[model samples]
Target: MPVPSPYALLLSNVMVREASVSVLDSSTSYWDYGPPNADTVVVAVHGFRGEHHGLDPVVAHLSGIRVISPDLPGFGESEPLRDLTHDIAGYTAWLRAFIEALGLHAPVILGHSFGSIVVSAAVAGGVEASKVILVNPIAAPALSGPNGFLSRLTLLYYRAGRALPPKLGGALLSNWLIVRFMSLLLAQSPDRDLRRWVHDQHHTYFSRYATRDSVVEGFEASISADVSQFAPSITAPTLLIGADRDPITTVDAQRRLVELFPDARLEIIPAVGHLIHYEKPREAASAIVEFLGDGAVAVSEAAA
Candidate 1:
């Protein structure tokens, strides 16, 4: 049996708390893990079609420092922005405002998949962060990825969902089979149990968007921007946790993308695709713990 992760914190534990904060006139629901008093705070952003719960696997492998994972506007329990387009600019602004609202002081910022683009843009555009971490970061355009053809089909899927009437659109967007199919293609876990869990996760939470517009617009936004655009401006040291078999950006692309940053290191987990959080979360967490240094342990100790 695989060893239990060292920095591990179980998701089922009662220690995980739910909290909320108002940002941009909307209530953002978040999951708080680790000690509330832990000085190092890492605000995590979930991927497209994902809520805070999606990062539970990776977060479970991390402790000592507090992690705040919010459901992006319109996903999970969060409401959509009052009057902003759901584009990169809107998300970038929301993330910055969200952090400020929480009174975080240069907390480490982490993002996964679609979230990576948002965090990268926010950090590059001047939302302060002590450090940066990108999991399965999108290095290239979605339409130009290794799974370019499938991505194009997915673009069509989103467009179709938007064009159809509300009931039909929501039905199509929330189709369980499609979710499982997409999950299968991207979830490269060889372990059957892990694969089943990933499929279950997608089935349970992947299509929980508040509105058809939110899902469609978010999909468009996700494919529209990538970390490459913000890499050069992110002055803080960054870590990119990549996968050798990632269906979207290849490890080669990840390598090239890391070089563009002023200070960034790439960690490529083998035998996994985009779902590093599922297939190889232990490795991802190990890389992050090392990048963060002693769990930012000094902060809590100093405060004490």
Candidate 2:
């Protein structure tokens, strides 16, 4: 796939060495979009098994803003943590390291799906950010509740599959099955173009190794962590985007997040799925642009 050229931007990648963190091999890829002298910086984090390209639309919409999106450890071009700490704690440490390494201060973080949870955790832990945009953030309670027997068994299969050799797992679970499985999570009546966008993301962002690793580790962590406990500690202004029709992030769960955050704005996108950014990129992007405004109004007003 051809990567589109950015307008007057700087792009680079670096391998990060963090002794305290248990990662396979950590690397960071970044793009400095728009003007070099741009004041506001937007940092986006993709969801589980997702890469930087998954945030392309959001990046494009904020053309003049400085945008930096990176592939999480074990995803995209970055190497997996050597310690295989794929849990939220590990991911958070990685984020801190990445930010410190890059010298980004209180950036406006845009998180999608699992990424939203990660950022929320960061905020809960007292990590600082100018603002937060959570797109289809996983509702903690919904994910923790009991699932069907068959669903549990299917998850077990994936767990067992993870222990198998990577090559064997890839050969057994064809990309087609992956796509079909993902489609099940999407809105049943998604537009043709939106379906294509989802398909493209499946291929481009999800690597066989990274996908399996993330699923196994992420599921365990999501169920284990009490994210609701962290909500009150988040000091950064937050924007929570939810989809009424999303199978994963239910409306109730989104509301729970809103109630927990001391400062948050909720936007429920009707008839959209968890992939709200893809299904309603323009609307989603507009909401972000409006929240993180240009000059004039004080930070207080922009946050309001």
Candidate 3:
């Protein structure tokens, strides 16, 4: 059972806290590059169905910066949240704990796709980071209105999916079905390789824990997450990077995100897809380098 190349294994360690709470019960893996003691630290969070391997190249190109790209819970070696409440908010809390556990500075929090949702939640909840970068981020609509529809719909799907027998649940959980759904909903130009990669990631990482109940709970939590309250609270300078051709998180959504932040900058990458960080990592790293080089002041200047 060889896993996908984009999903390289990094670790299998767990976290156990007092009061019998096993904070992290799975191996936490990441694609770490750059100097450990570098003046600036950067943490990269992967998107839905994404793992650390996709970030390896981006992390590698970043020098003179301490980079930590962790696999999100249930998505990689990091175990799923107990009872399946692993929504974006729970993921944000877990990440904050992971950062504190490692005793690393807040540094620059960079998120791709779904990771952007969690990053926004973290920043809104007062997770101290020097700055923030969102690369082709998803969950943009969550920031504004008709806000409860997606979450409630997800909860409904989970309930419907679970009513069926376990054997039949396979269809709902099938990679083909999932990829098709994504192709129709998220990917504008769905190709064979991209479809295969999506399937490979789901099979390797989410197949087991992604039961009807868990997914339902995950959806319920994600949709119910109140990021609008969190968005305005963000004090860190924020940068939103979008791919011109991205289907998941479009340029329009990126522009809307700019309105939510107190201080934010938007950059549109041409000829790229949703995974801007993976597609042009060196350029992505360079953006961070430039951001870090000037401290928080440049972000204001750039935004203006």
Per-model clash counts, in order, read 0, 6, 3
lDDT of 3 by residue, 141-209 (tens): 543444346545655656676777887765665446664565444433344554465445444554444
> Would you give me the overall lDDT of model 1?
0.85
- Worst 10-residue lDDT window, candidate 2: 7-16
Which candidate leads in TM-score? 1
Q: Model 2, residue 142: what's the lDDT?
A: 38
TM-score of 1: 0.92
TM-score preference between candidates 1 and 3, better one: 1
TM-score of each: 0.92, 0.81, 0.72
Q: Which parts of model 3 are misplaced by more than 4 Å? A: 1-27, 142-159, 180-212, 225-229, 294-304
Residues 12-99 of candidate 1 have per-residue lDDT tens digits of 4426788888989988888888888986789999999999877877777676778999999999999888788788998998999999
Alpha-carbon error at 121 in model 3, in Å?
Answer: 0.8
Q: What is the lDDT of residue 189 in candidate 2?
A: 39
RMSD of each: 4.9, 6.5, 7.5
Candidate order (lDDT): 1, 2, 3
